[model samples]
Structure formats: C-alpha cells, structure tokens
Target chain A: MLTTLKQHIEQLVPLTDAEFAQIASFFTEKKFKKHQFLIQEGEAAPYEFFVVKGLVKAYHTDTDGKTHILQFGQEQWWITDYQAFYSGATATLAIDCIEDTHVLCITRANRELLCANQRKMEQFYLKKSSFGYMALQRRILSLLTTNAKERYEQLLLQYPGLINRVPKTLIAAYLGLSRETLSRLS
Target chain B: MLTTLKQHIEQLVPLTDAEFAQIASFFTEKKFKKHQFLIQEGEAAPYEFFVVKGLVKAYHTDTDGKTHILQFGQEQWWITDYQAFYSGATATLAIDCIEDTHVLCITRANRELLCANQRKMEQFYLKKSSFGYMALQRRILSLLTTNAKERYEQLLLQYPGLINRVPKTLIAAYLGLSRETLSRLS
Candidate 1:
C-alpha cells in the first residue's frame, strides 16, 4: 500500500527511501465497506483520502434531492470535499465507497506541514493540482459544448475501462444526463 | 506593472525586494487592443499572461462554430490555454482582449526555471494551483446541479461586479444559457 503511494509521488518527483519514509509518516490508513460514507454532507471533512484499493465517489444532492456525481476515485486517485478540507467548512459533497475500500488519509494540517517541510512533495502536489485543474477545465468545456451523446463518447474515450467499472446510472448523473438518455447514447 | 505582479505574488508568499527583482526578471510585459488575440486556436500558446490592466476572455468554438466562454480574465487574473500551455499542445481555446489590456507574460520554461530556483515561488504556485482547482470543482458542481436561474444568481453573488463588466452574451455562454433565458433570469 505504501509502495502504491511512493510510485504515485515518484511519477512527478523522485523520492529517496528516507524522503519517502518522512512523507509516509504524515498519512494514516483506513478501510471502508461498500456503501460506507467517507464524508457526509454538512459534516466537517477533516481528511482527504488517497485510494489504495476499491472505488469511491464524491457527489452532491440538489435541493430537489437529485444526485449529481462529481467524480469517482479508483486506486491511486484522491477523493475529498476539497473546498471543505482546505477551508475548514462543512462538507457540501458526500463521498462513499462503491467497493470495499482502503485509503491513506491526510489531514489539512499534515498536508500543509508536509509541503512546507519537503520541497519535492510541494512540487509533486503542485503538478498534481495543475493537472487536476486542466482536467476540470476540459470537463467544463465538454459540458458547455457537447450533447449527452458526445459527452458519453468522450468519457468512454478518456477513461477507456471506466464504463465497465462505474454504474451506468452514476455515469449518467456525472454527465448530467438522465439514465434513459445515457442508455440511449451508450 | 511590476508592482501589480509583486502584489499578486505577495498575496500568497511575501518576498524580499531582491527576491522580487529576481522573480520579476523572468517575465515580459505586453499590451493589446480590444479584440486582439493573445492566443489563437491551432497555434502554440507560448506564454501565460497575468492581467495588469483591462480584461480578456478565453473561449472555445465548437464544430458548429458556437463560442463557449470558458473564463474571463480581469485585472490580477491569469489567462491561457492551460492544456496547451502546460502540455506543449496547440491551443484549443483562444484568448482575446475584451478591453485594451496590459499584461505580464511568462513562458513555460521560465516558469519551470523560476520554480526550480526559488522555493518560495514554487510554494506560491502550489497554493495558487490548489485554489484554482477548488474554484473549478465548484464550477463543475454548479453546472451539474443548478438550473439556469440558480446559476445566474450564484455567479452574480460570487462576482458581483463581473455581471456589469462582461457582456450579457458572454455571461449567457458562461452559464450555458441562451441570451434570452439569461436576460429573463436577470
């Protein structure tokens, strides 16, 4: 599990054994069963989770009680109510496991401390954040310019195997399409 | 102009005069007239601009030739085809002046060099990138969950002065609403 994290970090910045050890110290591990919520809306989101195994999703429920999936987290992916985690606000999004899950969790304090203490870790996170921003920008563009069919196709292309893993209804929600529309498109 | 950039940087990380001078050395200043493009689709986006004066917008034209506004950049804002800029790809979005604009620009190489040489600058970028990611995440959620009227109201609340500054058509595009619909909502 630690090796999974070390490799993820190394994808951006090379880490020595000692450096990896120091970086690993900041994170604690946890597990969840299917349908278990890692974050519940209106609660404090104290930690961000990095998935080592299984799947999870972060989503918002609208005033009408419709769910809108924001993102799905697989192995090596990070999931949280990031705004709440960073700003100390109550969570507006809920996260739950799709499969039995294991994740490494880091608190806001420890994340800041790790970045402050390790320049390489700061660079790693900087790269990750930039890539994350770019991905969201693409999603926004897709939402603005594409129809449901186009979006479904684009998602299929981008994530390749994701269609097989994520529930079709959840994918429909993420694309802002009804399940019927998604089924027709697929 | 340098003071503008200094103040922006200092918002995240305080810098000594000497350090500021070194950091400022990497950027070049440029000005553009209204409707002039800083970045054009299909060309390489060589620099990311930090607006010192006036306004700019970045948008993409779909296959049907409809323009979707991705973002508007005002004073103290940064604008670029980020996917192209970061990945060495050709521009997919075009950035053009909405008002006669003055900006400080930095190339990818210079940005990398600055981060490598200055730990403070790297930290500054890390913080900025994280905030940028969070903002995009909120926008994604807004797109997924909100109705046109709700989105219009949210945008107005978040950027009170922006509604008046940007043209209604662009705002409509940004909100994914028809101009008539936006006008009715407003």
Candidate 2:
C-alpha cells in the first residue's frame, strides 16, 4: 500500500527515501468491509482517504431518498467530501465501501503541514487539484450537452472497466438516466 | 487593473511590493470589445485571463448547434479553456466578452515558471484550484438534484447581482432552463 502511494506521488514529484519516510508518517491505514460507511452525512469528515485496494463511492441522498452519485474511488484513487474536509463543515456526501477496502488516511491538518514543509508534495497536490478541476469541467460539459445515451457512452469510454465494476442501476443514476433507459441504451 | 490583480492575489497570499512587481511582470493586460472572442473553438488557447473589469462567458456549441454555458467570468474571476490551456489541446469551448472587458493574461509557460520561482504564487494558485474544484462539485450537485427553477434560485443566491447584469436568455441558458420557463420563474 505504501509502495502504491509512493509510486502515485512519484508520478508527479520524485521523492528521496528520507522524504518518503517522513511523508509516510503523516498517513495511517484503515480497512472497511463492503457496505460500511467511511463518511456519514452530517458528521465531520476528519480525513481524506487514498484507496490502496477495493472501491468506494461518495453520494448524496436527497429528501426523496434518491441517491445521487458524486464520484467513485477505486484503487489508487483519492476520495473525500473535499468541501467538508477543507472547510471543517459536516459532510454532505456520504462515502461507503463498494467492496472490502483498504485506504491510507491523512487528516487535513497533517496534509496542510506536509505541504507547508515540502515543496514537492505541494506541487503534487496542485497538479492533482488542477486535474480534478479539469475532470469535473468535462463532466459538467457532458451533462449540459449530451443525452443519456451519449453520456453512458462517454462514461464507458472515459473509464473503460467501470461498466463491469459498477452496477447498471448505479451507472444509470450516475448518468442521470432511469434504469429502464440505461438498459435500453446498453 | 494591476491594483485589482494585486489585491486578488493578496487576499489569498500576502506578498511584498517587490514580489508583486516580479509576479506582475509575467502577466500582460489586454482589452476586448463586447462579443469579441477571447477564445474560439478549435484554436489554441495560449493564455488564461484574470478579469479585471466587465464580463465574459465560456460555452460549448454542440454538433446540433446548441450552445451550453460552462461558466461566466466577472470582475476578479479567472477564465480560460483550462483543458486546452493545460493539455495543449485545441479549445472545445469559446469564451467571449459579454461586456467590454479588461484582463491580465498569463501564458502556460510563464505560469509554470512563476510557480517554480515563487512559493507564494504557487500557494495562491493551489488554493484557487481547490476552490475551483469545490465550486464545480456544487454545480454538479445542483445539476443532479435540482429542478431548473431551484437551480435559478440557487444561482441567484450565489451570485446576487448576476441576474441584473446578464441577459435573461443567457441566464436561462446557463441554468439549463428554456427562456419561457426562466421568464415564468423570474
């Protein structure tokens, strides 16, 4: 798991052995069973998780009990209620394990301290945030311009293995299509 | 205009006058007339603009010739075809002046150099990108969970003066509401 993290960070900025050891001290590892909640709505989101194994999803449950999927975290992906994490607000999005999972977790304070001390880590995070913004921009464009069918196709193309990994109903929800509509499209 | 840029940067990260001057040297000021293209589809996006005055919007026109609003840039806001700017791709979105506009423009190469040289500016940009990501997350949620009327009300709350400044048709387009529907809601 630490190797995965080291490789992920090194993709953006190479780290010395001493630097990696120091960085590793800031994060702790945790595991969850499938269907267990990593974060719950209305509770403080104390840490952001970097998935070392398995899958999780962050979603909002509307008043009508409809689940709106905000994002999914698979191996090597980072997941959290970022607004809540950064602002110290209660989580609006709940994250739960889609499969039995292991993740490396870092609190906001530690993450900030790490960045303040390390220019390389700061650069890595800056790049990650920019790419995250770009991905969301693309999602917004797809929502605004594409029909359900086209959205499904776009999602499939963007995350090639996602269709097989995620349930069709959840995929439908993610694309803002009904299960019937998504079935037809598929 | 430089004062505005300086103030904007200072809000996130305080800088000495000498530091500000060095930072300002990397940006060039440009002006545009209303409806003039700041960026056009299929063209290279060479610079990202920080609006010092007036308004601009970025939108994508689909194959069917329908326009989808991505974002609006008012005073003190940043605007660019970010995917193109960062990835060296041709622009998919067109950004145009909604009012006569003035902006400070920075090329990607200069931005990289600035961040490499200035820790304060790098911190400022990281903070800006994180906030940008959070705003997009909210927009995604609004699109997923809210009706057009609800979205319009949320937008009104978020940018109180925007309705008066922008045309009703454009506002309608931005909210994904038909002109008649937006008129009725208003």
Candidate 3:
C-alpha cells in the first residue's frame, strides 16, 4: 500500500526510501462503501484522500437541491474540497464514493507535519498542486469560450478514460449542461 | 529595489534576508514602454516577469481577430504564459504593457535553479499557482452557470480593483461576453 503511494510521489519527485517512509506515515488507510460521504457541505474539511481503488465524486449542491458534479476521482487520483482545506473554512463541496473504495487519507495536521520534515515531500505536494491548478485553469478557459459541443469535446480529450468510468448525467453535471442537451449532442 | 521585491516574496512565504537575496539574484531588472509587447503569440515565452511598477495584460487572439484577455498584472503580480513557462512550449498567449513598466524578469534556467536551491521557494510558487487555480475554478463555474450580467456582477465582486484598473472591453473579453453585451449590462 505504501509502495503505491510512494510510486505516485516519485512520479512527481524522486524520494529516498527513508523519505518515502516519512511521507507514508501521514496517511491512514480507509475504506468506503458505495454512496458513502467522505466529506459534506458546510463542514470544515480536515482531510484529503488518495484513491487506492474504486472511484469518487466531488460535488456541490445548489439552494434548489440540484447537485453539480465538480470532478470525478478514480485510482491514483486525490480527492478533496481543497478550497475548504486551504482556507481552513467550512466546505462548500462534498465528496462521495461512487463505488466501494480503499483510500489513503491525510488530515490537516499530518499534511503540515509532512511539509515540515521532508523537503522532497513539500516539493512533491507543490508539483501535485500545480497539476491541479493547471487542470482548473484549462477547465475555466474552456467554460468561458467554448460552446456545449466544444466543451464536451475538450472533456473527451482531457479525460478519455472518464467517459467509460462515470455515467452521462454526472458528466453533464460536471460540464454544467443539462442531461437532455448532452443526450442530444451525443 | 530589493526591499520592494522582498515584500512581494514575503506575501507568499516569509523569507530571511539571505534567502531573499539568493532568490533575487536569479531575476534581471528591465523596463518596457507603454504598448510594448512583452510576448507575442507564436513565440517562445522566454521568461516570467515580476512587475515592480505599471500594468500588463496577457491575451489571446482568436481566428475572428478578437482578443480575449486572460489576466492583467499590476504591481507585484507575476506575468507569463504559464503553459509556455512550465512546458517549454511556444506561447499561444501574448503579453503587453498597458503602462510604462519596470519588471524583474527570471529566465527558465534561473527559475529551475531557485527551485533546486530552496524548498521554500518551491512551496511559495506552489501556493501562488494554487491561488490562480482556485480563481480559475470559480471563474469556470460562474461562466457555465451564470448569465452575462450575472458574470459581470461576479467579476465586480471577485476583482473589484481590477474592474477599475482595466477598460470595459478587456473586462468583457475576460468575462467571455461581447463588448456590446457588457455595455448593455452596465
């Protein structure tokens, strides 16, 4: 289990065995059944999870009780309400497992400890954070300028594997398009 | 001059005098006249600029010849085509000064050196990058779900100072609304 997590960190930066062990100590292994809530709106987000197996979705609910899918996280993906995590404020987003899942969970305290101890660990987190930032930037640019069809095409390009993994309605919600519109386009 | 740069870096992470000097050594100061192009589309983005004075805009021109403003940089803001900066790719975006500007510029090579030397520098950049990403995420969500007027309202709320600093046309482009539509909304 540590090996999987270590490999993911190594992809961002090379870490010595000791360094990896230091990093691994922060995470506690967890499991969730389908539809389990890993996080909830209006609660303080204290932890972020990395998927060892299965899938999860992060989403927000509108005042009207409509759910908007923000992102889907599968194996090797990290899931969190980062806005809340970073701000140390109440979460506006919720995370839930779409399938039975195993994860490595890191609490806020542990994350701080990791950053304090290992230079390489901090660098690894920074690189991972940068990747998330890039993805967010691309998504924003697309939503601003692209039409529904164009948005779908870009989504296809960005997450070719995701189409097979998640349902169309969830994809529609992620794109902020109606299911009928997505059905027509498809 | 160094004091001003030190303050800017400290906004992200508090740096000791020695650490600040080490990071500052990588930057080369330069000046540009108003309306001068810092970067042009189809060229390599050689360096990222740290503005000490005046304003700059980064934009892209579509096939229709209409320019879309991605971001505006005022004093202490970092400016570059991040895609080019990170991947060593040619820039699709162009950057230009709106006013005569003094900037501290860092080459790609020097940037790598800074990251290599200091874990704090890496973490600082990561924090800066994450803020931009968070902004982008909010912008995307707004664009997809909100109308032009609603988006304009959001722009005002999110970047009130920027609204006053830039022209309506640029604001319109940034919001992905036409100039005429923006005028009508106003």
For this target, which candidate reaches the highest TM-score against the unseen true structure? 2
Q: Interface-residue RMSD per candidate?
A: 0.6, 0.5, 1.9
Off by over 4 Å in 1: none
Worst 10 residues of 2 chain A by lDDT: A156-165
lDDT of 1 by residue, B66-138 (tens): 9999988988888899999999999999999989999999999999999999989998888888898988999
Cα lDDT of model 2 by residue, B132-168, tens digit: 9999999999999999888999999987788888999
Alpha-carbon runs more than 4 Å astray in model 2 = none
lDDT of 3 by residue, B1-186 (tens): 567889977888999888988988888998999999889889899899989988898888877787878778888888888778778889988999888989999988888789989867887887787777667666665665677889889878876677777788888888888899999998
Give the TM-scores of the predictions, in the order they appear: 0.98, 0.98, 0.93
TM-score of chain A of 1: 0.98
Best first by DockQ, ranked:
1, 2, 3
Clashes of each: 0, 0, 0
Candidate 1 chain B, poorest ten consecutive residues by summed lDDT: B157-166
Question: For this target, which candidate reaches the highest DockQ against the unseen true structure?
Answer: 1
- lDDT of all predictions: 0.93, 0.93, 0.83
The parts of candidate 3 lying over 4 Å away from their true place are none
Which 10 consecutive positions of candidate 2 chain B have the poorest summed lDDT? B169-178
